[model samples]
Target chain A: MSRPVRVSPQELRQTLIEAIVEVAPDVDPTTIDPCEDLAEQLALDSVDMLATLVSVNERTGIEIPERDYPKLATLDDAVAYLVHAAVRQVDAAARQEEDSSI
Target chain B: MPSLGADMESGTLLEWRVKPGDVVKRGDIVAVVDTSKAEIEVEIFQDGTVEQLLVAEGTRVPVGTVLATLQTTSDESERAQAPSAPPPPTEGPSAERPRVSPVARRAAERLGVDITSLHGSGPNGAITLADVQGTAGSTQAARAVKPDEAPAPSVAADRQAAMRQAIGALMARSKKEIPHYYLQSTIDLSGALEWLGKANETRPMSERLLPAALLLSATAKAAKEAPAMNGFWRSDAFQPAEHVHLGVAVSLRGGGLVAPAIRDADRKSVDELMASLNDLVRRARVGVLRSSEMFDPTITVTNLGDLGAEVVHGVIYPPQVALVGFGAVGERPWAHSGMLGVRPLVTVTLAGDHRVSDGAEGSRVLALGGRYRQRPEEREK
Candidate 1:
């Protein structure tokens, strides 16, 4: 139950678009795509993008502090972040399990 | 950017609020358009001096095109017109409060310390301490008590919850966000009712005068008498009003409250007042009210007397400082010509905003009640 599993690529695409629409209602949602950068396509500035980050944090509760925001430039970046954190958690849990068995 | 989308897509240039060179704020309406929707007004969402009108009013362009560019006043904003620049999220205060962030909305949650329901000047209407402290109320309701321990809330516990919630939202702003105080007096409603009874005898059912209409008259007169009560409270300052919008709080049947204001109540006649009061009540219950109906109420009056309430001292709805609450004008024994007699009486509670006037000044403004000297009685508990 604790092992990391791949987050579905399809789910990642859907949630990212959902997060953008929730963050920026005025932007035409039909034009939004996961691959399209928010700043270049939807005209989101630093503050508007911060609001989007807040929505993500509120939904996922992954404390992606502001300093790490530069790493999240595209939709794949978000998926990678989630997967990498899950792998770390699972690796720590496996070590604990191996110690218990020994 | 000052963008004018023509109404007919090609209607003639009707007029402009400012000539090409005039300065305008972000939301100021720049030009009126003759559009397919009708002669529509076009507004600018950027602050800059208008350099030119891009197209003559009669030119027809597809809806998706640019109306006008505000001219390169700042290099920072030249990019704003381009979707690529990411229009700096100004987040100027929207009149209708929007959904707030769960975390930034702490002032309201602090209970009696913040008012999130008011038009906030903060980021996206985030509840601010000043707004809460001004009203002196919070989203916090009174502590729960056992049924055996304390009296029930005046309205239903659940509906009271909604009522309190709505009241909490509305009052959070008026009490905390706006500077308010009250000025009250007892009206000798005895003569007015007598006059109203005679007026009712001659008039048709639809035209009869209720006490509310007369109360409306006095309030309008008093507000006009003291224009200071008509304005809104801005940050750390008070702006006396130019319009006298009167809000009357109508109690709903199943237990909720609605205060719908009659616009320009000062200029309206008794018959017009009666009609508007009727309309405000009907639409208020069904929830079909137009947003304009709630926007600018310079003064508000709340009457709980009809619900067996002796008197209700009102909370000022922020910005506007005074609220007059009407109590039952019941039949009570009184002295007429120094002899004991029965008469109908009305008690009015005036809640004032000290930001503008003090208790002494409030009493003077309340002198409108003096004209109604025939009120049945004056007794306070």
Candidate 2:
């Protein structure tokens, strides 16, 4: 899938918060501090954290590999990683489509 | 009808999946029964042909009431006779038992309670599990069967209230009848977490393992080591169980909770336990649990830590002599090898029935659980 319209960093953060809330219904979105460790702040266990990442992937179409999990310690970190990865993914999809057209 | 829980007195038959002349095997979901807690799918224990349906849809029958009559199936069909006018000979060890609930009869047989001398306090003066226990212990066995029982409510608010009452009855009974002795220990989880991280590094989200699985496995393994804390307190004595059927407390999304047993949990590995936990939680919330899962828990383990609780002092479920609880694993001040530092630590607690065991035996359970968690690689079973 191609994302002709780019998603902003703010939107990515919002998506991350929503995903976290979905994984942990007990967690309050308003209480989340973007700079702090999300797992620690929200009491997200390993399974909860993994589920949150999966929910994020489903929403943004950005696959966060297991190796890159450490990069998502905080909300800001996750947003930055997703924003960068989405751009790379969109660029790759665009190039592939252009090649197919040729 | 199966005694789904200690709090259950009667259940309303919702639907019958099997009809007369249909064949059913052991573990087959024969019918759905609605208790105060949830809608449970009742399973038949013996392979037999459905001879007749004794109870109809929407009939609220008390525990031990025969829902249907089954003619035993066998290879020797040549000797098979038509369904006789008289009731077929009762099958299994509970056969020919008069005035005793099936579950209570089984408990009596196990606990060596002389049913002939005791008087039943149940409906029609039938010998119930509490009656059998009363004969064995000095403490009064709580009467679970309510005489003026209300109909199963349909609305969510009413259902929630009903669940609250059910839980309240059980908890009050536990506190009143069982003299509980509690012991707590702080377990270092740095080693376990490190191992889990390395183990999950290459796996996808769906295949990854959770710390709760490890804790449960450890508790099951520990129950095996601490035999005194692994069985029921019945007939004024401790009846040690042969297998570790670990009860897991799963809270529903709507409201309230159910603690169902994972049979032979000690025999399962961490990966298998994780899979079972996932499937169990899914089915439990959806309210389609099996009869055996509801009835056969030898011990219970509650992990309130998953929801961010720092510590738990859980009440022991009746008949089961012990309850194991795990709090959230958090970074805490630790001293290791003469150095003070912060480490991921979990506070594990054991609530033991004083009538059956002492604090030393309870401590052994926590100690063994701590060892297994601190050294996950050594958890062979």
Candidate 3:
């Protein structure tokens, strides 16, 4: 299967906030800054984060590994990881196509 | 609405899932309540804007008490502000209000009631869980049930479901865990009928001895002779029952069963036993059986004779080491005084838990029925 491209930093933060909003709509998004640690600040447990992750995956095409979850607790973390990962995938696909062309 | 739990009478407003002025749809979980059964997320009954959250996180309110207001506009928060409401209904914390806003902050400074759940008529939904906690007695109305649901917290509903769940878990665990041994015996019941008939002629219908009334009488007599077969098993210790509480298993037409005990079954006579049995059966049918009635069974007596069944090998009700299954009786042959004779007979089955007793102990208890020569004489004995 073709790997999906990474989401933008803004989009990633929006995704996380949307998950929280779905669970707690009364909460103000401004209070839940993506740069801040979700666990320390929002008191998000691993289970809560898993729910958010599930919600995010449902909306996106990313295939994040379970092992990679610790790297994406914050919005900046998710964006940086997704962007770098997407670039590598795109480069690998382009190289494969070139070899096939030859 | 689906209930969060059976034991959840009320919950602490840990935090509002939605804030004032936020829009929500049906099925939206609007807040979290700390139910004794579980920490449940209270869902929106319908779609609307959150006008104000009446109770804050950590602030307690009984179940069905409005934690927040949902209206087409912000004006709907007033519905919860009614003067007639029950006051400061919080969960987890039984006595004090929740700790949320500044007064709650000062109080939280002193650990007062939390009120972050309170939506500010002050604007911007800034009233913290602390603020609501500070304004004690103002939130007293919050403790009350809504106008629509008279008893916001149906303790009975909680109790019944809790009782069922508890009964469910226990029976499930027991059937899976305990090794049961069942034994049955048929006795000449002709004497029981004639004895009861003569006794009823001298007494009123309200006090007349019925078959179960007689069986319970004999059961107590039997239990006293065989005390080892009564009571429960605990870790490293076995507790033998002192009082003779007779558990009469009443089968509801709906198909499940409950046993409401006749307390001090040994103390009552045939007439008194019948009256108590009638009251217990009535309460058991309605699911309003009390703790003592539902529990406190030193032994259980389940009658299947009414259903026209001849014999039944019953399951031992847990904790109590023995169960006596009563079945239909018919006239049968018996060798009496070295001669063959036909006599009315009834069969009693004893299901005992082997962990607490042996087959010999169960057999010994059943033999005590033979000691009571007359059914009427049992009442006086």
Candidate 4:
């Protein structure tokens, strides 16, 4: 079986920024404050947010549920959430691989 | 029979929402049609029973082709007998025989005016161009215009290809047919932005306004002042639209773009327009749009600000005579009181049909838009 891909926190943050920029082309990633609300700072509407989520999912192969979108209100929060989610996904896949081997 | 838009020669009947023998009320969505732009839900105007389905699904027919037969309570016999001859082919129904000239009929159809509501003033009680225009203006004032797709994770490549072809055809037709005259002006949006910022402070994040809402409202008001710039140029003539159904160009995440109408934009407040625009952009991305919204735009508005463009010279979406474009709103050196200072400026461009209006009228429209932006409070009024 192939080994699972590894993603670091900083890498995840960059991916998140790219995703946000892809969704809203007008937003400048360098100008975004990590702690500021992305919706207010970037003027991201619900549709824009949805597109961002889709972009993140496509990039990281992690599906974030709509209910948990509020947790990703800021850049830092999104990065942290995505990193944790990615780790958990890799761990779950490893466990399944072990179980199948047994 | 619905003429989805001026460019649409025909639409494919994708599915029938209502089956025969089903009871349907006015404003009920009876069928779904796949137009050149998008799949649209078509609504029926008369309350009736579905007598028969004349045209089956998957049939691509021209505009004004009768799709189904309806048995109405008022004229049950006549309608039931004359199933072949459906009411005059237009978006809305004109139940009775309204005395309207051929030109007037075409004008009413293009303007989304209900002929039955108009009072005829011509000889033999016939409705003329003036009569239609008068009724359209008054009807707009009298009527208080009160006004989602499944998660497809993977973008459909075929849909994108189809949309690209459709857009190419439409743009080609536009360039070939319309004599377009372009005019642009840079407006200082400092006042508008300041007012918007202050106004947004009290509102919730969900209800907060975007600069697009302000632009749309301003364009609608400007169109109201310069009526010649708002309407369809069809049948070798120009028909002015009384109400401003502003078509907003929304880019899809996958590929291509669709500009659906926000019906009666001048009548709606900025906040209301924001809500409508949000809904439109969301649905447009998801590929679920109503028939009326697809076809009803009197003029089109495209904002390339998001793309960071300084100016956009857009092609006129036929039969719409004008297309208003708003480009990047950024800080620029300005002279307000003979003093140089940095202010937020937006380059607004108007691409008008030279057949119907000239640069002078287009300039007036842009000036009106700038004036409206200067006084943001007037947007809601």
Best by DockQ: 2
CAPRI classification of candidate 3:
incorrect
Q: What share of the true interface contacts does candidate 2 keep?
A: 0.13
lDDT of 3 by residue, B1-381 (tens): 123322234455654556667789876766644433223445666777866556645666665665555675445443644422333333322332232222123222232334444444211233432233335435554542222231113542453465466557757766776778888777777677787667756642234456677777888778766777777766745688888888887754223566667888877776678778766553333223343354367888888764557888877666677788878656678878899999877788898887878888788777776445245464574
Report the C-alpha lDDT of model 2 over B59-106, residue by residue, as the tens digit.
787787777778776643222333222332333223222355434444
Candidates in order have lDDT scores of 0.54, 0.76, 0.58, 0.74
Q: Give residue B339's lDDT in candidate 1 (0 to 100).
A: 92
What is the DockQ for all candidates, taken in turn? Answer: 0.01, 0.10, 0.01, 0.04
Docking class of 2: incorrect
TM-score of each: 0.45, 0.71, 0.46, 0.66
* Model 2 chain B lDDT-worst window of ten: B144-153
Error of 3 at B358 (Å): 1.1
Per-residue lDDT over B1-381 for candidate 1, one digit per residue giving the tens place of the 0 to 100 score = 122211112332333455555678876766544322123345566788765455444455444344445654573333223221222122322343333322122323443333335554333443333343334333333542222221223323533464456566667766665455555555566777776666666653345556777777677767877865667776777788877888877644234555657889878876687788766654443222432344467888876665456778888875567887887667877777989887787778778777777777677667754553333122000
- Candidate 2, which segments miss by more than 4 Å at Cα? A1-62, A65-102, B74-154
Candidate 3 at residue B102, lDDT? 21
TM-score of chain B of 2: 0.78
Better of 1 and 4 by DockQ: 4
Chain A only: list TM-scores of all candidates: 0.63, 0.90, 0.69, 0.92
Task: Give one digit per residue, the lDDT tens place, for model 4 in A1-102.
Answer: 223253698888878876665444323466799999887777665557755776677667775654477799999898888888888888888899899999
Candidate 3 lDDT by residue in tens digits, A10-93: 776676566654332223456566686665455443334554565565555455555576787776776677666656666777
Query: Which parts of model 4 are misplaced by more than 4 Å?
Result: A1-102, B58-62, B76-158
